[model samples]
Target chain A: MRDVAIVAFAQSNCQRDAGAQNEVELIMPVLTEVFKQTGIKSAQDVDFTCSGSCDYQQGAAFAFVAGVDALGAVPPIKESHVEMDAAWALYEAWLKIQMGSAESALLYGFGKSSPGELPIVLSQQLDPYYLAPLWVDTIAFAAMQARTMLDSGEITEADMAEVVARSRNNALKNPHAQLKGDQTVADLLKEATYVSPLRRHDCCPISDGACAMIICTIEKAEEWGKPYAIIKGIDHRIETHHIGSRDLSRSVSTEIAGKAAGVANGPVDVAELYAPFSHQEIILKKALGLGDDTVINPSGGVLAGNVMMASGLSRIGEVAMRIIRGEAKRGVAHATSGPCLQQNLITVLEAK
Target chain B: MAQLAAVVGVGQTKYKTKRKDVSIAGMVREAAVNALEDAGLTWNDIDAVIIGKAPDMFEGVIMPELYLTDALGCNGKPMLRVHTAGSVGGSTAIVAATYVQSGVFKRILTVSFEKQSESNAMWALSNPQPFSPHLNAGAGGYFAPIIREYMRRSNAPYDAGIKVAVKDRLHGAKNPLAHLQLPEITMKEVEDSPMLWEPLRFLEACPSSDGACAMVIANEELAAKSPRKPAWIRGAAMRSEPTMYAGREQVNPRAGIDCAKDVYAQAGIHNPRKDLDCAEVYVPFSWYEPMWLENLGFADEGKGWELTMSGATSLTEGGDIPWNPSGGVLCSNPIGASGMIRFAEAAQQVRGEAGDHQVDGAKTALGHAYGGGAQFYSMWVVSSEKA
Candidate 1:
């Protein structure tokens, strides 16, 4: 396979509400920023374009179509899209570059989670015939898993609060974070619960945002590189859609993807994980076989701002930024989709 | 760097304006089963499933793929959903094939569909969002201005587009699966058709059809052993550009041209008009046949209309590069599925399976689809002989 690297990255601000700006309006600025910083003058120069987004966010069909205007897509360019997160879109583009079909590729993902009742909207991702009809919101589902973990002594409310505290404290340094403060674990534990066993702090804030990443082959990577992180390996896996079919407390998909991407082999200096819910972080860490010594979510991660599709791609970008800055030699970035991380993708990036 | 891929099987649902007889799951299954049958395989033969559709609003279902897992026989298997506006069908197929080309999955089932009967496509397409003014009504509303630009640039006669509409509709007569089969469709009738968007007569545009198209793709080895003759995939390419940009050419997009050139190079075709036996190009509107003909390298700049006028795309006329023998998108369009239909039709022609609309002696064919203001493009070349 040909070498590919994340050459540039940009994103819109993470916000609680996207009042008038829809998906397209939200993503346009990010597209410009990504290209502007990369010094790529023409959209025509990009060989392939791929995106990660869902139709539910816009409450409209073909929501991604409107995004074309943002890319200045006239004079058509090779493109593809995934209903998954933008991180997976990046994976697709990486494959294209590896196949030698494209020299450089653009990847983006966005979602406006504040328009309607986000928890209710997310319920639609459940099994349509069975679980979805129950109208169980995401918090309720997470609470149930939390209860299982609590009963099994795998984790505690105190541990959950610690995760929340550490994540929020870390977010104080991130300018794009939607939530950040120096709240202590004891104080977080005292917060009111949105759902039983799951406090507001335990859940990722509903965020509206968009993000873009540019990747290229080794030669193009050199052309665009001021600093870029090479994607060493990337892979994704999906478990059964039936929620009850698998153990809810474990993320089998993450394990599979991590193994496939070679993340399970050894230790990594940094890790960026998409854990919208606090307890999910614990689940993900175990699935990925990360030790306590590994520094995770140095970029504040999704717990600071959960922008659905964009958060996943942002994880890769965050890790790549670290590699670019010479902060880390190797990093593992993971993204998840579906209920309880039913689908997961992992990418291992390294500095050459 | 990439492994070769082949279209081992192809399938499509019977095209219609409303497919209310079955649920969304049933609709997808119809096409998937047909594809499996063509590949001489069963549900277990597929290692993964990739699906595409225009939008959630089109069918009043959000992220319908989650609900459709069982319908497409994706249980305990990898499933991906792709959405890139109108060209999603084509892009969806490309992603599925990539799995095989990347040597990840041996056999993959890719499908695209839209059930327009469940909801009004016009209203869905025009559904106003926040910030953006509701200027465009439907797809035609956005494309009409581009079409007008094409008219001015080409300096083609007004009758040129009307002729395309008449020809495609006439071709639709032979396609049992085509939605519009106006046996007496004439240029005079198209000229009299109602104008929804300026310069775009109603009859010249594609009808909103409820349909699905499915294809089974495999590696060279599996394809060679398939029960049916495989349409060896010579090349596949996709491209995209921003929808709104200063100096952006809407009439003949650079992405389309670049995509065509990329795919042709991969297929090792230097002269498309002679190298390709036939083509199933995406032409949601009648005039698109000639426009895309030029875009796809079948005609010179500003002379694509001449090919349409010369009857080079007719079904029985035996034109060198017979285009849309299956009547094309002007006859039927389930936005999400339209691209795959072009691909499936191309494969069908190569397989000698297009019963009535079959172009005789078709060996090498091109399938093309574009969406999102003509920004997203997905195309492929298939030949009877393996490369």
Candidate 2:
């Protein structure tokens, strides 16, 4: 396999609501920043382009088609789309690079989460024949998982508050974070509950954002002389559609994808997880078997800015940037889709 | 280099206006079972499943693959869903092939389908939303101006569009699975038909269809062990651009040209008109037959209409490059499955299984599909001989 590396990455700031901009407007800045970093003049220089976006988010079908204009596709360029997280777009670009079909690939993902009621919109992802008809919102779904953990004596309400405290403090350092403050666990415990035992701090705010990344072979990475983040391994898996069919306390998909991605082989120095809700981060850390010494979500994570589709790839871009700047040697990035992480993808990246 | 991929088995449901006789799951299963049977394998032999479609609104099922996991026999394996407008069928197959080419999976199952009968396609296509102009006009309304431009640039006769409608309809008569099979269609009948859009008569447009198409792709080891003949994928390519921009040319789209060039180069075909035996292109409208002939390099610009008028696209005629021998989208169009049918028909011709619509001694076949205001394109070349 040819050695593929992440050469460039950029993203628009996560906002609670960017009413003036649509998806296309939100993506223009990200595309410009990525190109400016590489010094490439034309879209033709990029051999392959791929994007990740959802029709539901934009409230329109084929919404991503307008994104092509940001790349200035005048003579037309080789491209593809995935109705998935932008991270998968990066994965497809990586495979194209590995095949030697394209020397360089550009990947982008965007979402406008503020357009609709997220909890209501997310319910549509459930088993439409059964669960969706009930109209059980996403918070209520997460509440069930939290209740299961509480009943099993695995965690307490105070433990959840501590998680909120730590995440909010971490977000204070991130300029793009939508939620950031300095508060203690005691302070969070006194907050009113939004979904019984799950306070407002436990849930991430609805955010609008976009992200872009560039991938190239190791030879090309050196030719360009940019700090490189090598994708060591990647895998994804899905569970039964019915939330009740599987154990809510555990994520079988994460375990499967993690094992396939060789999560146990070497020491993981850092972890960036796509956990929109607080308890999900706890569940993911346990599933990944991270040690206490391993740092997690130093960039405030999704708890600070959950931009739906783009948030997942932004986690990857953030970790790659850390390695590109000589901050970390090895890291793991995780992305999830569906209610309560029914589907999961794991990628291991290394700086060599 | 990676192990080359080949289509060991191919399957498709009967093209029709509506397959209400079966549910969406049943429609996909029909094609999947046929492909597995053709390969002499079972669901257990498959490693993963990749499925795609134009939009979830077509069936009122958002991410329907989740509901279809059990029906597709992909519960315990990895299943991926790709959506890239109408070209998704071809892109879905290419993604599955990549798994084998990347040495990840040995045998992969790829399928794409559309149950247009479930919902009104015209309404679903024109759903109004925020921050976008309402496309109240249907596909014909969107494509009329481009057709007018093609006529002006080519300086073709007014009867040229009618000739295409007559030719493909006559060709549809030979295929049993076609949706619109008129045994005796005439140029006068087409010309006199109600005009839905200027430069395009009602008969010149493809019918709304309900159908599915599937294939089983495998690596070298499993491909060599297949019971039936295999159509080696000589080349495959996909390209896309913005739907509209300040200076974008809608008449002769560059996306089509770039995609064709990429695939032709990979297939080592310097002169498509002379090297290719036949082509199954996406012609939802009759005029697209000639437009694509020029875009795909099968004929020179401003002369594609001449090729269609000279009876060169007929299977029985001694034409340089016979086009749409299996009736094509003009006769049968299940929006999502239409693209895969082009792919399956190409494989069928190279495998020598196309009974009545077979092009004599067809060795090289082109499968093409485009969508979204002609901004997206997917093309592939299959050969009887391995590259």
Clashing pairs in 2: none
- CA lDDT, candidate 1, residue B185: 80
Query: Mind giving the per-residue lDDT tens digits that candidate 1 earns over B267-346?
Result: 99999999998998999887788899898889998999999899888876656678888888999999889999999899
List ranges where model 1 is wrong by over 4 Å. Answer: A1-3, A11-13, A18-46, A59-62, A72-76, A126-134, A151-153, A219-227, B75-77, B145-162, B181-202, B244-248, B300-303
Residue B284 lDDT, candidate 1, scale 0-100: 89
For model 2, what is the alpha-carbon lDDT of residue B79?
76
lDDT of 2 by residue, B151-181 (tens): 9999988887787787777778988888898
lDDT of 2 by residue, A1-352 (tens): 5567888899888899889697769988888888878777656788899888888777777777777778788777888888888887877777677666778988999998777888898777665556778888888988888888889998899888777788789889888888889899989888899898688989888889899988888888888787789888887777777766778878877887888888888988889988877888889988888888778898888888888888888888888999888888999999887778877788888997
Looking at model 1, give its docking quality level.
acceptable
